[model samples]
Target chain A: MGDLNTVVQSIINLPPAVILALGALLIPALPKRLRSPWFILLPVLALTFLWFLPVIQLSDYCIVAWNYADYSIMPYVSDNLSRLFSTAFLVVLITGGLFSWHNTDSGEKIATLFYASGAVGVVLAGDYLTLFIFWEVMAIASTWLIWGCGDVESGDVGMRYLLYHVLGGGLLLAGILVEVMNTGSIQLQSFAGLSGSDLLSNPGVLLILLGVAVNAAFPPFHTWLSDAYPKASITGAVFMSALTTKSAIYVLIRLFPGMDILVWIGLIMAIYGTIFALMSNDFRQILSYSILAQLGYMVTAIGVGSEMALNGATAHAFSHILYKSLLFMTGGALLYSVGTNRLSDLGATLKEATDQDPKFASQSRWLFGFYMIGALSISGLPLLNGFISKPMIIEAIGEAHYEIAMLILIAASIGTFLHTGLKIPYYTWFTRDSRSGSKPLKQSLNSKASFGEIPVNMNLGMGIGATLCLVFGIAPVIVYDLLPYNVIYEPFRAYPIAESLLTLSGAFFIFIWMKSRLLTPGVLRDLDTPLRATLPWIRQVFVDFPWAIFEKAEEIVLAFTRMVIKTVRNPLAWLQPYSSEEESTSTHSTEAFTPAIEIVIGLILFTSLVLGLFLIF
Target chain B: MINASNSERMNQSSFFTRLPLWIAILAAAVGLTLEFTLLRGYASHWWNHVPAFYLLYGALAAIALLGLSIWGSKVLNRQEAAGTNEKEA
Candidate 1:
C-alpha cells in the first residue's frame, strides 16, 4: 500500500496530459484578445509542473511468477535526465506557442497540441513501449501539420513525408520488439556497457541502433525531411524544425552513446547536408538541410561519447530548437508578406521603403537583423548560443583524437557559414535588382506597405525565439546547467573562446571575399535534381514506352485475331481445303487415317504395357 | 520540317526515340548478368550484393519491347516523311 502511494504521488506530480488535450478546446472559447495569452500560459503551466515533479523510479506493473493477481501499476519519477529533457521540451513549446499567437487556424492549434503531446510523451516515457507509442504519435501529428499546408504540391510532399516517417517508425518498433524479446525488459536507459562481442551475442542492440539511426536522419533515409519540411506551412515548419530530429538525438544520446559508427555517419551527414544546402535556392529548403547538418554536429558529439561531448550535445539540442525555429519563423514572415520565396525574385524592399513608412522598413529590417543573429548563432558566431554548443563538439572531436572527423566538422562549419549565414541574407535581403523585370520596385513596395508588419502575435513568437537565441548565446552557463549530464568543462574559458572567435572571423572574411567576387549566390543543382527533373523524365519515358508497346501489341494481336476470324468464317476457305481434292483425295485420306489409327493403337499398347508392368510388380 | 526526306528524318528521330530504350536495355542486361554471377557468392558484401536477377531480366524484356515499338514508329515516320517530301517535290 505504501508503494502504491509512491506510484500515485509520481503520477500526480507529473503535469496533467489533459492540459494539452483541452488547450485547443478552451483557447477558442476565450475572448479573441485572451486567446494568445492563454496559449502562452498553458505551456508555462506544464513547465511549472515538470519542474516540480519529484525524482523517483517507479514500476507501473509488477508480476510474480507469471501470476495475474500480483500485477499492479507502479509510478516512478526516475532521474534528473528525464526532467532535463522534459523541461527543455516544455520551454520550447511555451515559447513556440507564444510565438504563434497570431495563428487563427484551428488546424495549427490542434496540430500544435498533438505535437506537444508527442514531445512530452517522449520525455516522460519510462519504457521502450511507452516511448515508441509517443514516437509514432509525433510522426502522425507532424504529418497532419504538413498536410495543413493547403496546396496540391504540399499534399504530394506530405504523402512522401508520411511514408518515410512510417518507415522510420516501423524500424523503431522492430528494434523495440527485439530488445524486449531478448532482455525480457522494456526499460529505456543507457546501454553504455554493451560491447561488440555482446552486440554480436545479442542482435537486439543492432536493431535498436538502426531504429534510432533512421529518426536521426542518418544518410539515405534523410530525404523525407528535406523533401517535406520546406513544403509545410510556415508555422508547421517552425514546429517541425524543433522536434523530430532532436527527439532522435535525445534517444541516441540515451541509448547508443558510445557507438563509433555514429561518429563517421555524423561526419558524412554534416558534409552532405552542407554541400546540398550550398546548392539550394528555396528559403525553407536551405533551413531544412541546415537542420540535418546541425543535427550532425550533435550526433558526432554523441559519438565522441565523453562526458563533455554528451553535455555539449544536450546543450546544443536545447539551443538549436530555439534558434532554428526563429530562423524558420523569420523566413515564414517574409513569405507571408512577399508573394514569393524564391531568392532571385526577392530584393532589399526594406532598404527601398520610404522613411515615412515607419512600420514596413523598420519591422522588416528588425526581422532581417534578428534573422541574421539567428544565422550567426547557428554558424557558431562568438557570444551567441551556437558559440557555446559548437565548440564543445569540436573539443570532443579533438579529445577523441579523430583527426579526419574534426577536419570534416570544421569544413562543414565553414560551408554552413557560406550558405546559410552569408548566402541566405545576402540573396534575400541585400541583393540588387533581381526582381526588376517582374514588377516596378516602387509599386511592389507600395503593395507590401498595405500588408504592413506581421500580426502582433506572430511578431511576439518570433521575438521570443530571437530573444532566447541571444540569451542562450550571451549566457552559456544557463544552458550548460540545463544539460542532463554533469558539466565539468566550462564553455567560457578564454583560450577556447578566442580560438572559436578566430574561426568565426575567418569564416566571415571568406563570406565577404566571396560576395566581392559575386560568388555568394547562384543556382546550383543538387540531389533533388534527380527527383525533380530526371526521375520525372524517367517516369515519363517508362510510362510512354509501355503504353506505346502495349498499343502496338494490341494492334498486332487485333490484326492476327482478325486474320484468324476471316479464315474461319469464310466458307470458301474451308471449301478450298487440302490441295486439289480430286487429285489428292486417295493419298491424303490414306495418310491422315493411317496416322490416326497408329496413334490409337500406340495409346492402347502403352496402356497395356503399363498395366502388365504393374501386374508383374 | 514535316517535308524532310525519309532518311534524314529517320536519322533525326532515331536518336531521340530509340536511344533511351537502347540504353535502358543495355543497363538492364548488365545489371542482370552482374546479379546472377556475383550475388550468390560469400565474397560479396551485403551492402554491395546485387538484388534478384529476375527484376533486371524483366526490365530488359520491357525495354527491348519498347525499343522494338520505337523502331516500328521510326519506320512509319520515315514512310510518312517520304510521302510528304514527294508531295512537296
Candidate 2:
C-alpha cells in the first residue's frame, strides 16, 4: 500500500511537460469538436494535479549525470517561484484554449499544446539546458501557428518570424554552452554580478539575455511580432498574444533579477509599444503592440528585483494574461461576424439592428460590452483588474527610486488609454460616422448571415475570463495568496486608489477633448512600415542586382564562346586543315574536338612554366 | 487609394523620426564620449555598476529623442495639412 501511494505521488509529480507531451499525442485522436475543449481541460487537470502534489527541494533532482548528458531531463516543481509561474501558466493555457474553442483547425490545437508545454518546461526547469530545450520548442511551435494562416502574406511573415526566433534560440544555446563550460554545473539558481568572473557573467549570460530579449519582443527585434500577429487567424492571434512574450518575462525574472539594463529597456518598450499602437489602424495589430507595452511594466518591475517588485511582476503577469485574452476574444468575435478586422471596415453593429432585426444588435451589444470591460481593465481604470495589478507595479517602481521609469510608465499608461482603451473600442464598436455603412450593407445583403452570436462554447469561454477579470479587480487577495513571495505591499491603500483614479480621470478627460475636436479618426502608422514596406523593396534591389551581374557574366561567356566557334569555323584560320570535311566527320563521330586538344596543349605549357618557377625558387 | 509614391504615404512619424538629426548626432557623440572617457572610472567602481549607468543614460537619451520626434511629427503634420487645404481652395 505504501509503495502504491509512492507510485501515484510520483505520477502526480510528473512535470507538466510530460502531461503536455501526452496531450499532444491525444489531440489528433480527439474528434474535431472535442479538440480545443480537451486542450482547455488538459491544462486544468495538470494544474489541479500540481496543486495536490508534495513540493520537493532542488537537490532532489539530478539534472546532469556523467553518462546521460545528451538526454534532456526536466526538474519537477521545487521552488515557490516555479510553482507560482506554473500555476498561472496553466490557468492561462486553459483560458486561452477555451476562448479559441470555436476555431476548429488541427494546427492551432497542436501548436498551442506545444507552446503550453514549452512555457511549462521553462517554469519547472531545474537547469539551463532544460530551459533552453523548451525555449526552442516554443519558438518552433509559435512559428508554426503563424504559418498555419495559410496565405502568401502570412507565409512571408512567418519566415521573418522564424528568422528572428531561430537567431534568438541560437544565441541562447551558445550562452548555455559557455555557462556549462565555465561552471561545470547546469543548475539555474540565482547568480550575482556581470563581470565575466563567474558563469553568470560569461558570454553565456549575454547570449541568453539576447535570446530572452527576442522572445520578449524588445526593440529592433520586435518587428516580427507586429508584422505577423495581426495577420494570424483570429483564434491563433489570441493564443499568440498571451504566451511567448510572457514566458520570456518569466525567464528574465527568474534568471537575471536586478539587472539594471532591463529597467531601461522595459521603459523604452512601454512607451514605444503604446506610441505605435496609437498609430495603427488594424485592430489586432493594435492589440499586438499593446502586448509589448504591458510586458514592459512586468519587465521593469522584475528589474527592481525586490520582493515587492517581483510579486508585482507576477501579479501583473497573471492579470495581463486574462485581460489580454479577453480583449483578443472580443476582437476574434468581431472578425467572425464581420469578416474583417480593419478599423476602417468596422461600424456599430449594435445600433444598426432595429426592432425587426434585433438579433444582430443584441449579439453586437454583448461583444461590445465585453470589449468595454476588457479595455477598461487594461487601461487601469479604477475597480477593474488593471487598477489592482498596475498600481502594485507603479509602487515597485517608486520603491526602487526610478523616477524616470515612473514617468515613462505613466506616459505608457496614457498611451494605452489612447490606443487600446479609447481608440480600439471607439473605432470598432462606437463610431458610426467615421467609415460609411459598407459593413451593415454587406451583412444585410447576405441572407445566410443569421445575425447570431458566437457559438455557446466561445461565449462561455469568454464569460469565464470576464468573470475572473471582475473578481480579481474587486478582490486581489485571491491572487496575492498564491504568489511565491510573501506580500508586504498593500494594494488597497489610499495612495494607490487615489493615483489610479487620477490617471483614469485624466485619460477620460483626454478622450473627451480629442473626441470633441474630431481628432480621433485619423490613422497612425508604426515601426513596422520599414519592415513591411522598405525591406521587401530592399530585398528586391539586392535580388535584382545579383541577377543583373549574373546576366552580364553569362552574356560575356556566351559572346566569348561564339567568337571561339566563329574562329574555329574560318577557312583561313590555322585549323583549316583540321576543319576539312573528312577530319571534321571523324571528330564528330568520335566526339573529339580540336579545341579540346588545343586547350590541353595550353594547360601543359602553363603548368610547365609554373613548374619551372617552382624549381628555380 | 493607398498611393505608393506620395510622400504623405510614409508612416506617421514618432519620436525617433521627428528628432532633429543633429540631436541624435549629439546624443551619439555624448554616448561615445562617455563610453571612451568616463566609463573607465565608473567601471573601476564596479564593473556591473558602470554598465548599468551606461544602459540608463542610453535609455534616457533614446526616450527623450522619441518624445521629441512624436511631438515634432504632430506639429509638422498639422502644418502640412493646413498647407494642403489652402492649396486645394
Which predicted model would earn the best TM-score?
Answer: 2
Q: Write the per-residue lDDT of candidate 2 for residues B1-89, one digit (tens) a residue.
A: 22222211112234422332344344444444545454434322232244434334334433443354355335422211211110000
- Candidate 2 deviant stretches above 4 angstroms: A1-10, A54-73, A195-201, A348-357, A436-450, A516-617, B1-89
lDDT tens digits by residue: candidate 1, A397-461 = 88777866875686677667666777778776566455524344443332533434577766777
Report the Cα lDDT for residue A557, model 1.
100
Q: What is candidate 1's lDDT per residue for B1-89, written digit by digit as tens? A: 22223222322355733553454345445434544554345222222243532343223322332333234323322111111100000
CAPRI quality level assigned to candidate 1 from its DockQ score: incorrect
The DockQ figures for the candidates are 0.01, 0.02
Instruction: Give the number of the best model, judged by lDDT.
Output: 2
> What is the Å distance of residue B10 in model 2 from its true position?
37
